[model samples]
Target: MADKEIAQDDQRVAVVTGGSSGIGEATARALAGDGWYVIVAARRVDRLEKIAAEIGGGAVRLDVTDDDSVAEFAARIDRVDLLVNNAGGAKGLDPVKEADLEDWQWMYETNVLGTLRVTLALRDKLVASEGLIVNMASVAALNPYAGGAGYNAAKFGLRAMTRVQRIEEATEGTNIRVTEIDPGRVKTDFSLVRFKGDRDKADAVYEGHLNLGPEDIAEAVRWVASLPAHVNIDRIHIMPRDQV
Candidate 1:
C-alpha cells in the first residue's frame, strides 16, 4: 500500500485564523511572502477569499467558536507548520458591576475556548513539523481597567493557557514552541466590535493616541516564525512608542 500523497506546495504551512482582516490578514500576507504555504481561515468567507486570492493562499470558512466547524476545517488540511490563533475579539465595555454575563461568555468562547479548539485539532500536525504557535493576546491580558473586565479576563486566561501549553509541550519532549504576543493598542476593528459597531465610539479610543498598526503586529509574527528552531521567543509585548 502506498502512503497518501499530501499536496504540499511549500516546505512550511501556516494556518492563520481570523484572516479576513486586520492583523490576521496582514500576517497571512507577510507569511506567504516569506515562503509559507499559508491557509487563511475565518467565518467571513467572502473577505477570506479575497485575501487568499491576493496572497496566493487557500481559504477555509471557519467559525472558531463552533467545534463542528473547526473539526471540518482541520480535516481539510493535512499539514501545518505554524498555527496563528488570532480569531478573537472584545465585546462590550461596561464595568463589571453593570457587565453583561452574555458578553463575558461570548468573549470567553471566542478568545479562550476557540483558541483551544483549533490548537487541539492541529496539535498533531504541528508536532510533526516541530512548529510554532502564536496566540494573539493583548495588553489587556496584563492590565485591568474600568469597563474592560470581559476582555481582560479572556486575554489573561489565554496568557495562562499559552504558558501552560509551553511547559507541557516541553515536559512531553515536543519541539513545539508557544508564543503569546500582547499588543498594547492596535488601530483595528477591535474597538468597533467592542462598541457594537459604533464607529464614533471606536474612533475615539485611538483619536489622540499613537497606536500600533496591524502590519506592525504582523511583522512581529513573521520575525518570530522565521527565527531558528532553537530560539523560542516565549512572549513578546509590542507597543507604539507613544503608548507609554
Candidate 2:
C-alpha cells in the first residue's frame, strides 16, 4: 500500500456547496485560481451558472436536504480533491424562547445535516482522492450570541460532527482531512437572509463596523487546502478584529 499520507503537492478537483453566494462563491474562485477544477454546487442554478462561467468550472443545482439532489450532483463528478461544506446560516434571529421551532429545525437541516448529506454521499470519492473537507461553522458555535441560539446550536453540532468524521475517516484509512471554519459576522447575504431581505435591517447590522467579507474566509479555505500533504488542519476560527 502507498503511504497513508497526503503530500501537499496533490492537485485535484473541488466541490463547494453554497457555491452560488458568499464564502462559497469566493472559495470556488480561489480554488480555481489555484488550479483546481472546481465544481460549484447549490440551490441557485442561475447564480451557479454565472459563477461556473466565470471560473471555468461546472455547476450543479443541489438541495442538500434532498437525497436525490445530492446523489445526482455527486454523479457528475468522479471524485473530489476537496469538499467545502459552506452551506449554512440562520433564517431568522428570534431568541430560542420566542423563536419559531421551524426556524431552528430549518437551520439544523442546512448547517448540520446538509453538510453531512454531501460529505457522506461523497466519502468514497474523497477517500479515493485523498482529499480534504472544510465544513463552514460559525463563531456562534463557540461563543453563542443573545439571539443566536438556534443558529449557534446548529454550528456547534456541525463542529462536533466534523471532529467525529475526521476520527472515523482517518482510522478507516481514508486519509481524508476534515476541518471546520468558524467565522464571525461576515458581511454577505447572511444578515439579509436572516432578516428576510430587509435592506435597512440587514444594513444596520454592519453599519457601525466593517464586518468580515466573503473573500476573507475564502482565502482561509484556500490556505488550508494548499498545505503540504500529511498536514490535516482541524479547525479554523477567524473573525474581524473588532468582533468579540
Candidate 3:
C-alpha cells in the first residue's frame, strides 16, 4: 500500500511461496518477527506447517507448477501486502552436450513458469493492496555457467519475466512494484537440493568462505518491503563479503 495507507499489520498478511526452507523459511520468520501475519506455501506441507507454527502465520501446500493448486492457494490468502515469489531452483547442472531434456524442462517449469504461475494468481490482490513482489532471482541470472546451461536458461527467462511484468504493471496502471533479489553463493539446503542430497558435494559450494545465510536475505527482504511506497527498490543484488 501507499506510505500513508500502510497499516501496522499490513505487511503481516503476505504469502511466501517456497516457504518450506532456506531463504523462504528465513523470510517468513523475519516477517513474522516484524509482526506481519505471514502465509507460508510450498509442496512440503508438513514443513510449511512447522514454519507457520514457528512464525505464527498460516500454511498452504503449493506446487507452483500447478495452476489449480496455485489458484486455490491464492484464494485462501485473504489479504496479501507482499508476495515473495521465491519458489525456484537449479537442476541438471550439466553442459549442453550431455544435458538431459528433463532437466531443462524441470528448471523451466519450476524456476521460470513457477514464478509466473504464482504472480498471475496473486496479481489481483497485489493490485488491490498496491503490494510489492520480491522475486528470489540469483546472480546466475546475470552470469553464464559452463555446466549450468539449463539452470541459467530458466533463470534468464525468469529475469525477463520479471522485467516484462514490471512493464505490464506500468501500462496497466497498477501500483504494485517488483523487486528481484539476486544473491551470489548462499549456504542453504539449496546446495543439497542441487546435489541430490549429497552432503559432501553440497558442502563444497561454500567450503572456502562464508556464504550468505538465509536470515541475511530475510533481513534484506524486510528492508525492501519496509521502504516508503513512493520509493520502490527496483532490484537488489546481494553477495557475501568473501565472494567479491
Candidate 4:
C-alpha cells in the first residue's frame, strides 16, 4: 500500500533510520510484523518507498547527517514510540598512517552526530510514550584493530552517548528505556561501504565466516522494544557463534 493508503496503525509507532537497506531495512520489516506503525526513513527515497510498501508502513526521505534534513524528517512525525539509531556505517579500511580524513569525518558525522540529532528531535515523543531507544553500536566500540581506528572512535563515542542517555533517563525517572546493541561481524553492506565498493574486499570479510544476518539484529531490536515498560535492557552484545 502507498503511504497515504495505509491506515493508521493502532499499535505503537517506530522510526527506523538507514531503513533503505541492511539492518535498518530488516528492523523496519520486523517491527511492522510485530504490529508497529513503522516509518522507514533513509537517504534513498526509492528504497524507502519500496520497503514501506512491502511492509505497509510509511517512508520519508531522511539524511541524518544534515541538521535541516533531520529536523524536517522529525517534523513529519507527530509521535514516535521507538527510535532505531541505525544510520551509520564504516567508510575506508586504511590504517591511521594512510587514513583519509574525509572518511573519518564521514563516519563520525553519520554514526555519532546523526544519532544525536535524531535523538534530540524525537526525545519529547519518546518521553511522552515512555518509549525505547535502540542504538546500533558495533563490537568496534569495545575492541579496536589496525585499520579500524576511525570506525572504532565513532562507535566508542556512540557507546558513551548511549550510556549517558540511560543515566539521564534513569535519574529523571522518565521510565523511558535505552538499549545499546553491539553487533559483531554481521554480513551486510557494511563491508561494501567500508571497502568503498570493492566487491572482493567486501566478500572476503564474510568468506568462511559464520556471520549474523540482518534479521538477527532486527530480532534483537524487536525483542528489546517489545519488553514491558518497567523493564530496561541497558546493553547487549550480539556475536555470531564463530565470531570470537
Off by over 4 Å in 4: 1-9
**Model 2 TM-score on a 0 to 1 scale:** 0.93
Q: Whole-model Cα lDDT per candidate?
A: 0.92, 0.87, 0.84, 0.92
Name every residue pair that clashes in candidate 3: 12-36, 12-37
Runs off by more than 4 Å, candidate 3: 1-11
Q: Estimate, for each residue in 1-244, the C-alpha lDDT of model 3 and write its tens digit.
A: 1121122444547789899999999999888887788888899989998888887788888999888888777777667789998899876567899998987898899998999889888788788889899998888899987998888888889899888888888788788888888988888888787778888988988898978899999999999888888767877889988875
Q: How far is each candidate from the true structure, as Cα RMSD in Å?
A: 2.7, 5.1, 4.4, 2.2
lDDT of each residue in 1-244, candidate 1, tens digit only? 2232143655688999999999999999999999887889998999988998887778888899999998889888889889999999999999888989999999999999999999999999999989999999999999999999999999999999999999999999899999999999899998999999999999999998888899999999999999999989988999999875
1-244 per-residue lDDT for model 2 (tens digits): 2122121345578899999999999999999999887888898899999998898888888999888888778777676789999988887888777988988998999999999899989888888888899999988889987888898899899988988998998898878888888998899989998898899999999999968999999999999999987998888889898987
Looking at model 2, residue 4 earns an lDDT score of: 22
lDDT of 4 by residue, 1-244 (tens): 1223233755688999999999999999999999998999999999999999899889999899999998888778877899999999999888899989999999999999999999999999899988899999999999999999999999999999999989999999988899999999999999999988999999999999898999999999999988888898888999999877
Clashing pairs in 4: none
TM-score of each: 0.96, 0.93, 0.93, 0.96
Error of 3 at 157 (Å): 0.8
